[model samples]
Structure formats: C-alpha cells, structure tokens
Target: MKNDITTRRDIEQLVNTFYDKVQRDAIIGPIFIHVAKVNWDHHLPIMYSFWAGILLEERTYVGNPMMIHEALNKKSPLLQYHFDSWVRLFYETVDELFAGRNAEYAKEQGSQIAQLMHHKMRESEQ
Candidate 1:
C-alpha cells in the first residue's frame, strides 16, 4: 500500500521521482534540459525544500519561483499546453507515490501554482 507523504524524505522521493519523469517528458523536457539548462544537483534539493515547506510546514525554502519561471518563459515562450503537461505530470507523480490528505493537498497546490505561474507568464508576455 502507498503512504501519505509525511516527511522530508517523502518529499525528496516525490520530487525526485517526478523530475525523473519531467526530464524525459517530450513536451517539457527540452525546456528544462536545453532551454533552462537545469542543474539537477542544485534544482532537486531546492524542490525538496520547497515541497517540504508546503506539505510539511518546514519553512525551509526561500526563492522567487515566479521570477525564475518568468525568465525561463522569456527564453522559450511558455504556452498553455506546457502548463497542462506540468500539472498532469505532477498529479501523476503524487498519485503514483502516495495516497492521503497530504498527497491530495500536494496536487491541489501544484495545480494552483502551475495555473498562477502560467497566467503570470502570459500576462508578462502581453
């Protein structure tokens, strides 16, 4: 049986597993690997802290994700479908690894984050 995400380790696992998929996702992979040139070593730990703060209330993350994404969008115009694929992949990741309130909450927050970021990116473009 799968478990509800309840610890930092769980957050790390979720983030790692999700990014494994993201790195291979044809829709967004190049955006990360080629466009953004993400440093996984650097990015993954930040994500662990980010999600842990959100899901565990650890308050360890401190960065402006919107600004970062805005810069990335400037480099490669982010479209609606890219956001859709992101949300889909995030939900798939959470569901695959966990089941419970926290898991559900992660999806809820991820969806909202994606939608808001996508909206802000579009607004900036116009």
Candidate 2:
C-alpha cells in the first residue's frame, strides 16, 4: 500500500485502479459495459477530477452525479446490491493502494457518495 493519497497522481491512480476492477467485475461489469457503455477515455479523467475535487479540494469536477446515476437507473435500475458491490470495490481499491487519513477519507467518501446516489435513485423511482 502506498502512503495516503496526496496529489493528482494519487487520485488518478486510485480512480484508474478502481475502475479497472469495475470494468471486469462479474456483477457490476455488465452494468458498466452493456448498460451504461462507459467510455473509459472520456470517463476516467472526469473521475480523476471528481475524486480530486473531493479529496484535494481541487474544485475541478463539475457535474450532477445524481442526475447521471438517476439516468442510469432508468436504464437498469440500480439496487442496493449494486451500490454495495461498488462501495466494496472502492474500499478495497483504496485499501490496496494507500494508507493513512486520505485513504480512510476516500473510502468514507465513496461510501457516502454511494449511499446518497442509491437513495436518490430509489427516491426517483418512487
């Protein structure tokens, strides 16, 4: 494990590693590949910016995640299991790559974001 994430490189590393796993995961991979059809070239940098904005206060990320995820849910309704699996991968990736406060914060933030996204998605369905 590396020291806690401290720079853009660290955030990029985390995002890349986590997404690599997501792109191949049995449960979640199809959601990304078939349903969402994510284009990593366009998506990865945005994620880097998103996490950087959260962890480093970079203020580089700009977009409404809830709206995006809500749209995705409309295509293939996200369930608790999906969110749980995502958070699990995220936490695992963080744990694998780094250690210390920022690492913990990354996991915590990922959890909070997943919960919020899941809640909003569910609420929108109702």
Task: Report the poorest 10 consecutive residues by lDDT, candidate 2.
Answer: 117-126
Residue pairs in candidate 1 whose N, alpha carbon or C atoms collide under 3 angstroms: none
After superposition, the stretches of candidate 2 with alpha carbons farther than 4 Å from their true spots are none
Tell me the tens digit of each residue's lDDT in model 2 across 1-126. 369899999999999999999988998999999999899999999999999998999998899998898888888989999999999999999999899998999899899989988887777777
Residue-by-residue lDDT tens digits, candidate 1, 13-45: 999999999999999999999998899999999
User: What is the number of residue pairs that collide in model 1?
Assistant: 0
Candidate 1 error regions (>4 Å): none
- The prediction achieving the highest TM-score against the true structure is 1
Q: How well does candidate 2 score on lDDT at residue 42? A: 98
RMSD of each: 0.7, 0.9
Evaluated with lDDT, which candidate comes out highest?
1
